[model samples]
Target: MYGHDNKQFFGNNKLLLPEQPVHDDFLDTMEKVFHWSCIFGVFGSKRYISILWSALILASLVVIEYLAIWKVIRAVTGVARDTSGHRSITARLAGTIFYSISIMSLFVASKLWYYWRSNISLLWAKVERSVGVKVPADSTLKRRLYLVFGLMTFCSMFEHTVSMIASVGLDCPSSLLMKRYVLVSHGFLFMGQDYSEWFAMPLILISTLASLLWNFQDQLIVLISIGLTSRYYRLNGFVAKLCELEKHQTEFNKKSEALKVYTWRKIREAYVKQAMLVRRMDGALGGIVMLSCSCNFYFICLQMFLGITQGLSTDVMTGIYYVVSLAWLCTRVISVVLSASGVNTHSKTALKYLYTYETHCYNVEVGRLQDQLTKDYIALSGMGFFYLNKTILLQMAGAIITYELILIQFDGQGQIDTETTPSIHLNVTNI
Candidate 1:
């Protein structure tokens, strides 16, 4: 019989999360591809690629990002000197620098993960395994993973597609882009451009793959969080069950009494262990999150400024490219923040129902769970710099808008000064 000492009618206290409703085909494929691993500890040497392979992938990404920087520098120095849409090169250079930093952060994160793989894997296993702590095979987590990965993938490809079309439609052929932009062979940014069907084909393929890798880092955090969040959710359900059991008096024998205590203890232990694991992950991967956030915030502000400075008055092709690129960036940044914030949002959700539990069901286990949740302040932070949440997303948006406006004013003032201010020529006389 189910553990019930009280005759209380057991009402289900399942807390449904309305925020993350998603499709999971994407994750199923990735699990098969990565062989169910994210942390270095999880990746047994059984992957299609080995340590050497991972290192090469990282090295290739670094090389590609470097080429992007080099290409931007080259472009600024000479390429498109005659082009009317010259202001874009400056924004491109700035975006390249930030993009390079984001790429390096992922590389660093990978190395660190490998270095501490053992400890992380241990933590991961503990939080994931507990009695009555199973997420459904068809849970929304899988679907969510699929949805985000798909949306981001589509957006990246779409942005690149638009840019290529604009470039070609404008009559700027592959040879021109190759001469102008440093054909970075790999990376998150769509910097590669070639008119040749053969040359453009490789660039297009690489850009898509690079984009997937870029998104994978942040999405990996989301994946881990979802895993942890799901566990918490199941545990909370048991707590609700405990509360319901107390609401109505249920008769039980000595075995039932022990079951009640054991189940209660397991629930509390699971919550604590899960909470600690979250803190540990925050320390290890905080920098990766920080770098991603910084890169996204900076580019948003910069892009907005550039977008306004060079409006529709510019050629229709360039205008189209601007809008598509900005749309992709905004989508990427918002999804990452919301997905990450869900961990914090959902972790503490049990509190809402915990207070409503009948007093008879209240015990030391419930007390501790409630107390811990209330004070734990569980959230993914950037090394204690900033926490991820929906509120933070709004705050960042406000800051970026303010910054963008200021940048525009500065740019406009400089242009006005150049046009209105008279140049004075000084004649030097030999004295």
Candidate 2:
């Protein structure tokens, strides 16, 4: 009688995600190893040796990027620098967005680092005390999170590397780059432009890599945590389902009773730990999520625009490379959204099971969990302003479509002007 409502409440398992711990663990490990490999590949083995050494290397890199590299390149090429291409309105707008997000990421990372270091111990204490639920430090999950930071670092490095290559190999002219202008590096400190391109190249590469690595690393920590927490929510749902099924067994033999009791306790323990992990993650990530998500929305949009523009290059390889890069970015964004949505879906499923059980057998803990579930569905909110969900994807799609249409119109108008210019000049001469 207790679980008669179970069948009535839940008939479909189509939306459920199957548990695959081995596969997940393998992926987690692989991503971490790949990320670290990128860091070591770009920088030398000594880069991670000491904070002081690392700081000095990073400072040197900043100088090269902001001051020396472009001048050296210009001197060697002996070509009077052309600023027209990168001075275009779209280019300036793109640069503004890039630097704004990048700088914000750095600032946010610093604050978050401080917060995480200071509050993490207290947060762990809270989790430990929370109904005796002690979530063990998941080394695998920790490594996976670190991997995300590494991946983001590698992405920044890859982008900068390609930009440098394109500028040299393809003769791509871009004035918006910091190395090209005398804004920060030349005026205030009065640094000289006497460096050779050979000297500047390595410095430029290292500096760009170092500057953004920490920023991206910081952002990805919050991002990956959000994703991991979502997965735990689903795990919680699975545990809940198992618990409900265990409770509904009709065969009440001695071994069956013992198994049921043991299983129920394990499920309860699991449910508690999973919930604690999600809550702790949410608490730790709350401050950065708002700004991060807002910035990410715009950043993703800008990236999409750049990707489309870049993909239209005359060089087939260049076009393909850009397309692949865009695909990579899209995959990351989609993964975040899907992870968040998974939490919502699974929590609701868990709630469904609880509600049905309540209809037949009244349990105080079930009612409390149901209330909590109803009140706080596992959604990531941006400073309580906007919730990250699949709907953001739809909004982004609409924005992309609108922007593309406008770009098409502008291109058509430019073509019309070019075509009619000679005729207009001829008519003026005749008059």
Candidate 3:
């Protein structure tokens, strides 16, 4: 099927290193982590240590949550009320869902890496080794990814550290048990048990720190995947430039019919090869994009709800920090969608350029390739459910706005009800 021509077009497949090896190397490392085997491998190497870490984190959060609800809130309000129905449940639910999706995304990303690793050698072998075509350096994309990674890391650390400190300083009744600050508190877990702050705080700190690192790594995997799309965009641009040149050459040299025919064939081959590579990679990422988009949207919506309902006046600095962290997270999802959309747009542009000129000699082949391009444009879907692109952000925006409006109406009605209720007076409450 044009085996020799494939070799001639792609040149030395063994030497298909990109101009930006560092970025490529970084992506390679991330791919290794994204593999599904790494999950079991962590248990194999660390075994009980990893289990202990998870247990400690869970325990700390539970204790903290219990104290915050039962001890602190009860003492302040002078009522033995159960805070189980607090709005924080929304956040907890979102976190749990996102964490599960994050784990699933790892598997998806791993499969993507596996697919790419299997086909990358063949893809490189088919790449047209043209001296005239310049491989663009994609250092800018790499830099932006790292910058986002850094922001995510910084925000996570800041949020956890401040929360930990605030938890410790929270005043509670002398009779209250579990006298330590924690990331969260659970009521049922502490119903019959008493634990020392000594045993809890250290575990909480270690678990919280581990969770932060884990989340950061997960996000890095996503960014790496997006970076590949960015690379695809650049490659598509290169092909488009080549097509433009071919169009001009055909316009000027009418006698060079054979040359024009061969050039168009090579261009078609290039497009086909690029499409195969991008399609396989994007397909592998299908589950990841679907899960991530759904989880991130819900997570962001929960954050906005909490931020709006939980008054900033309670702790001005803390509120601002929390809001900022939410903003950074929202940015990550937006960046990924935009990058995916960019890849699709570039591919369509290349297809348009391919059909921009027609040669009398290779008219049949050109038309065939053009038809294929129209049908085979690279698109990433959310696990066969929906297409993931810029429109995802718009959908999320609409949902968030609708939910906020509903929350506002409820809050106004609640305030009116409170104004009409009678107040109970406590006698000899203070010395």
Best by TM-score: 1
Best by lDDT: 1
47 Cα displacement, candidate 2 (Å): 14
With candidate 1 superimposed using the best TM-score fit, by how many Å does residue 1's alpha carbon deviate from the native?
Answer: 9.7
Best-first order by TM-score = 1, 3, 2
Tell me the TM-score of model 3. 0.65
Per-residue C-alpha lDDT of model 2 across residues 178-218, encoded as one tens digit per residue: 34322212211123354344544554444354435423533
Instruction: Provide TM-scores for the models.
Output: 0.72, 0.60, 0.65
lDDT of each: 0.55, 0.45, 0.49
For model 3, the stretches where C-alpha displacement exceeds 4 angstroms are: 1-151, 159-180, 183-193, 197-225, 247-256, 355-364, 410-431
- In Å, residue 78's CA in model 3 sits off its true spot by 21
Give the 10-residue window scoring lowest on summed lDDT in candidate 2: 422-431
Better of 1 and 2 by lDDT: 1
